[model samples]
Target: MSTQYTYTAFLYWLLLAGLIVFFLFLSWDLQLFQTIFVQDITRISSLIFILFIAVSVHCGYRSWFVASQSLMLLKIKKLSLDDLKLLSDDAFESRSVIKDFLSKVLNSHSEPDKTLATEVLAESLRGAHQVGWFMAGVVIKLGLLGTVVGFVLMLSSISAFEQLDISDIKELMQQMTLGMGVAMNTTMVGLIASMTLGIQLLLVDRCADRLLLETIDFSLSTVDLVVDNRGEGGAPLSAQK
Candidate 1:
C-alpha cells in the first residue's frame, strides 16, 4: 500500500475544523458562551476549552509530522542504494521514524533486521501521540470533576436550611441554578472536547500504521537486500539451503 494516507487525514481535519467553527458561530449567536463559560463560578468549562485548544494544536503538528514522514517514505521507495548513499544526512527530514529505520537498514552488515526496526519504529511513533491521548481522557475527567463540584455547591445551599425564610428560599433557588449550570456546562464541554481530540489522534494513528507497513515492505524489497554470497562456501542467498 502506498503510504499516501496524509491526504485523507488532511481532509478529515479540514472538515472537522469547519464543523467546529460553524457550531462556535451558532453558539455565539445564541449567547450560549456567556451562559456556559462566563456565568459559571467553577470555570471548568473555560479550562476545558483551553486544554482542548492546546491538544488540537499538538495533534495538528503531529499530523504534519506524519505527512512529512509519508513523503520521505515515497522518496526512499524511489531512490536506488547509490542515490540514497549519495544524499547527505541533511537531505532527509529530521526526527523521522522512517529515516531511522532506513538508516539502520542501510548501515547493517547483513540483511536488515526487520523485527528490530519495526519495534523501534512502533515505540517511537506511539510516543508521539500517547500524550495527546492521555490529555484527551483528562479533559473528560475534568468535566466529571466539575460535575462533582457543582453538586457540592448545590447541596451546600440547602445545608443551612432553617424554616425556609422568604429571602432564604430565593437565595437557595439562585444557588441551585448556578450549581446545575456548572454541572451541565462542564460535562457538555468535556465530552465534546475529548471526542474531538480522540478522533484526530485516531486518524494520526492510522496514518502512522500505513507508513510503518509501507516502509517495512519497501525496505525488504529494495533497501534491506540479503548478502547473495554468505550461507555456505559462496552460495547465493536463494540457493543457500
Candidate 2:
C-alpha cells in the first residue's frame, strides 16, 4: 500500500502505453517508417536522430520517476521532525537525492555544512536538467544537418540539367525532381523529429522544476523543525555560529 509502489506501477503502465502506441502506428502503415528511413538523403543521420529520440525518452522517464518519488514524499501529511529524520535515513539508504538532501540538512548544524548541502542539491538539480537540454539541442542540430544534406542533393542535380539536349529535357526534369524529393523528404523528417523531441524534453523540464520546488519546501521545513527542536532544549540556533 506504499505510494512509491503505486507510483512505480503507474510509470510501468505509462511505458506500456507508449509501447502500444508505437506498435499500433507500426501496424497501421509499416511503410511510413520505411519511406522515412529508406528514402532519406542521409539515412545515417536519420538513424542517429532516432537514436537520440530514444535517449531523450529514457532521460524523460528518469526525470518523471524522480518527480513522482518526490511528489509522493511531499504528500505525507502531519509529518514530524522524527518522521523527517526517518525519511532522510531511508532516502540516503535508497540513494535518493531528496532523501540525501534531507539527511545533509539534518546533519548540518554549521554554516559550512549547510552551504555544502546547498551546493550538492544544486548540482543534482543541474545534472537532471542538463542532459535533457543537451539531447534536445543535439536532436535539433541533426535535423538541420539533414536539411543541409537534402539541399546539397537537390543542387547537385542542377548541373546535369544544363548539359542535356532538348530531347533529354524530360529525363533532366525527372532527375531534378528526384533530387528535390530527397531534399524535401529528409528536411521534413528531421524537422518533425526535432520538434517532437523538443516538446518531450520540455515536459521533462517542467517535471524537474516541480520536483525541485517540492524539495526546497521540504528542506526549509526541515530546517525550521530542527531549529525549533534545538530552541526547546535551551540552545538557540545562533549558538552554532
Candidate 3:
C-alpha cells in the first residue's frame, strides 16, 4: 500500500488523536474524574474504544488495497485466460509482500484462493467491525454496576446516624448525579463506538466481496476457454496448481 494512505499509518495518527481527545475531555471534565473510581473506569473504557477504531481502519485498508490491485490486473488487454488464474493465485498467495499476511495459511484445494481470501475478510469483519456488539455487552454490565453502586451510596448516605441536614442532602444529590453520569456516559460511548465500527466494517466487507466475485467470474471464464475442446489448445490453470 502507498505510504501516504496506508492503514497502519492512519492507525498511528488515529490513536494519537484519540488519546488527545480523551485527555482533553478528561481535562475539561476534571470534576468527573475527581473521584478515583470514575477516573479508573473512564481510562479503561477509553482503551477499549481505541482498540476497536484501530482495528476498523486496518480492515478497511486491506479491503481497498487488494481490490485496487485486482482491478489493475484485470485491465491488461492482452491478459490470457491463464493470466487471470495466475493473478488470483499471486494476489492471494504471493509471500514477498508484507500484505501477504492476509494469506498466513494458504492451502491448495478446490477454490482455495477464494477460501483463504474469505477467511481473512471474515476475520477482519468480526474482529474490527463487530466491536460494537462486544462493547454493548460491556457497557450494559458497567452501567448496571454504576447504578447499583449509586443506589447503595444513596442508602448509606441517608442511613448515617447524624440527622439529615442540608449538607447531607447536597452530598446525596452529588452521589446520585455521579452515578447517573457514569451510567449514561458508558452507555452512550459504547453505542457511538459500535455504530461507527459497524459501518466501517460493513463497507469493507462489501468491497472485498465485490473484488473476489469479479476475480472469480473472470477466472471461470478463463477455465471455460481452456476446457473448450474445439477452441485454442490452451493449458488449464490445473497444470500450474
Which is the better candidate, 2 or 3, if ranked by lDDT?
Answer: 2
Ranking by TM-score: 1, 2, 3
Tens-place lDDT per residue, model 2, 22-137, is 85488448676666566665574466556555755665566566655565455432354445556555543356666666677777778788778767776775566566666666
- Candidate with top lDDT is 1
TM-score of 2: 0.73
Q: What is the C-alpha lDDT of each candidate?
A: 0.75, 0.60, 0.47
Write the residue-wise lDDT of candidate 3 on 190-213 in tens digits: 555555555555555555455445
> Which ranges in model 1 have alpha carbons more than 4 Å from their true place?
1-6, 91-95, 110-114, 223-241
How much is the lDDT of residue 215 in candidate 1?
72
Give Cα distance to truth, residue 138, candidate 2, Å.
2.2
Clashes of 3: 0
**TM-scores for all candidates?**
0.84, 0.73, 0.54
Clashing pairs in 1: none
How many steric overlaps are in each model, in order? 0, 0, 0
- Better candidate by TM-score, 1 or 3: 1
